[model samples]
Target: MAKNNRTLLLIIFLLGIFIGALDTGIVSPARTVIASQLSISSSSSVWIVTIYTLAYAVSMPIAGKFSDRYGKKKVFTLSIALFGIGSLLCGVSNYAGSFSFLLAARVIQALGGGGIMPVATAYIGESFPIEKRGSALGLVGAIYGVSTTLGPTVGSALLNLVGNSNWGVLFLINVPICIGVIITALIVKDEGIVKEPKKMDVLGSIIVTLLILALMYALTNLQFHDFKNSIASTKVWPYLLAFIILLPIFIIVERKSLDPILNLKYFTNREIALTLLISFITGAGMMGIVFVPQFGENALKLKTGSGGYLVTLMAIFSGISAPLGGRLVDKYSPKLVLSMGFASTLIGSSTLAFIVAKNPSFISLLIGLAFIGLGMGFCMGTPLNYLMQTNVDPSETASAQSTLSLIRSIGVAISPNILIGFISEAGKNISPKLMTILPKVTIPGSNTAVSMTQGGSSSISPDQLAALQNADVTTITDVLKQFSGSMIDKFSPMLKQQLQNSKLPKGVTADTLVAQWKSDYLAQIDAIRSSIENMFQSTLNEGFAKLFIGAAAIALLGLIFTLLLSRKTKPVSSN
Candidate 1:
């Protein structure tokens, strides 16, 4: 290939990666809006993201194998075409008014997007000589980091420009970009080797796909159940059973297969196995990127479009740091660079967690996100990829890259689910505290004997109050109704007596007093309702703070694994 062709190919590869990374996060900012439009709960709406990740994770290894078998140019062109079609379908689904259709379209999009990154990485790893690979791959990683960072910001901007009613524009924007990618991909020459085609691992692929699907479904759906119930209930048990049964089968099948979808041999390389595990852990830690927009909107009370600015700052820094991280890898050992990257992430996460828990300022948020971006730039760019590439034979480059991609996807897919579940349960736990904080309103007259009590009435025992405190919305509402009825009973006689004492003109009756009392009671109810809403909002903010702290802890855990990378390993150069 000529120098110009290689440059063009690199540009095209970066573009492919940019689109995939963009798609992963663009919907995050507008998630609540999408749920409202589709008349779905927030939990169910998250499936739009979860399903895409699930599909992406399942398709990556298969797509890698296809690229190896069919050639990079062919696979790359088809992936771009599929992505374009999927984007079109997503836009169509928005108009169709079916949540299921939207999820299906996302699946299609994921299938295409999944192939782009691993295949593109493999292409670069193979195309560039070993000495130049770090910098080249660093540029690719930088593009990915920038794209992921910009996704929320770009999506929010598009939502603002087109109006939130036209959120479909986010997905639609990808269509033209994909078309360009496809055109460039076709013009590029295929440099992949042609060998005797090996039989694809069809059985291994099915088992692995099913296994991942079951595990993700179980984990994501846990949001619907209480924490304890989620552990013990039959609802998630079947999926757990499926995962348990499938894992050993997958391992056994891969060991036996001549051409496995995922080669078990990679596990023998301690560095490779460790890198993959760290990739998954780091991927989970990166969930902060996805949720920061929501945290801004819900907790910090930022306007919908403004939340993305923080994400943009993070992306900008990541882009700047990525190439530098690559250069560092070239200068120093990958383990050293990786350690620095993980350390940056730990500091960033801890800073954000503290800020969220105490008082979140735009400046503080920006600074924290910048650190995270810096960490992402260093950690994701060359260090880990270099480690994996160095451990594998040249022929297994695509397979190794795909396996890494798959685990990372699994991590990303499950992170939000687990975090959201924690948030949900935390919110529930705070509800009783909110009830205890309910204001003691003076009933306005000594003549009225009614008083607000913890359990609503004297007849209600301690156990009953506890039950009411732990009850669902309907049960709580019923308890409120009973309390209101008792209050009315106490107030009615006093109201009538007061009305009787008043010297009214002709035609004024007791009914007029009753109507006035009814209006006053309704106003009181409205005031109480408003107070409850405010309390709920406060509790939610607290929940988000806890989640941020948890995320930071997870990042710190990842730092440990990152530190464990072999210090003795040296950078390989093309001689």
Candidate 2:
């Protein structure tokens, strides 16, 4: 193949990846808006992302097999067309105000989007000579990184410019890009060797798709319903059972089949299996991209359009690091490069966890994101080097990569759902703690006051005097005990300042002034309690911070797998 043609093909591949990446990033910032417009809860609207990932995971292996069976050109072009059509349908669904249609459209988009990556990867793996393949894949990874980084910013900008009410523009933006990809793809000469027609793994595909759907459905349901009380309450148990039963059956069928959608033999390779595991773990950690925008808006209190900027930092660093990582893979060992990448990710995630868990400042968050991006770039490129080099057969490259992609997608799909469950549970736990600290008081005019003030000879009733004394002493003591010493220290100066500014009636006695101050202090405590209870955003911030820690832990676990890569593994030849 001519170098010029290869360049053109690479360009087209990058564009395809860009569109897919763009769609993925674009949706995150607009999620709250989309939920409101559709009259759905925020938790439910996450299906907008979950369904796409599930569908993408299910479709990748099938698309890869189809590409191997037919030709890359045919499958690639078809995938782009489906994506465009899905985008159109999404736009139409938005216009029609139908959430069901929107979900259905996303499934269609996933069907096409899933094919674009694996097939493009297979094409490059086959077309490029071994010496250059690493760099080629690196470039592909870099493009993907840039697209992901830019997706949120672009989406946010579009949302801001067009307004959230027109959220469909995010989906619609893909149409023209897809058309361009289709046109560019047509110009690339198909030069790869075509394989003979083999039996399609229709049964395996169906079983695999069902398995993914069932598992994702079950996992997602955890956010909306309880799993322990009623197993059959929301189809969660049934779906989980379906997934459990299908697993062994799918394995048996795949091992016995002539053309398995996912060849079981690949898992026999320790390096490949471990690489796939690492991908899954890494995918889970990568949920930072999906949730960080919300965290920024809800936690950091950033403007709606600016929430994605933090992720953009991660993306930018990833893009910068990808090509460099690829070069390191070519020059040194993939194991070394991959380990370094994992370390970077661990550092990034830990930093983010620390910042979020403590006092999160925007600058500190950006620094954490930068580390994450750098880590992502290295992790993304190095794993492909290991997978392609160690376990994949040249002819079955697409299928192998797709299998890895499918598993990784599953990891990504489950992470947000699980993390969301954690966040919701955290909120539930914290709400009670907040309630316990609420002020309990009895004012002077109340019945409780009548008994204590009986001996008073003033205009105020004896009961009222007693109640005022109870409120000023017992209630205040209890409220003060709830706060830490440091908090009380902080509270005193502010209270004093407020009291100093307060006006008193002329000729009031010192005793009366003291009573007035007590009343004002109790009122202030009540106000603070009310504000805390009403501010659900604070609970959300706490939940997000906890999830960030979880993500960091997952990434740290993935780093262990990177260390386990076999030193003796070598690149498989395409001969």
The lDDT per prediction is: 0.73, 0.72
lDDT by residue (tens digit), candidate 1, 434-470: 4464444334333443334543446555665555554
**lDDT, model 1:** 0.73
The reply for model 2, stretches above 4 Å from the true place, is: 38-46, 223-233, 294-306, 429-545, 573-575
Instruction: Indicate which candidate wins on lDDT.
Output: 1
Q: Write model 2 residue lDDT over 159-189, tens digit each, in one string.
A: 8899989999889988998888888878778
Estimated TM-score for each candidate? 0.82, 0.79
Per-candidate alpha-carbon RMSD to the true structure: 6.0, 9.4
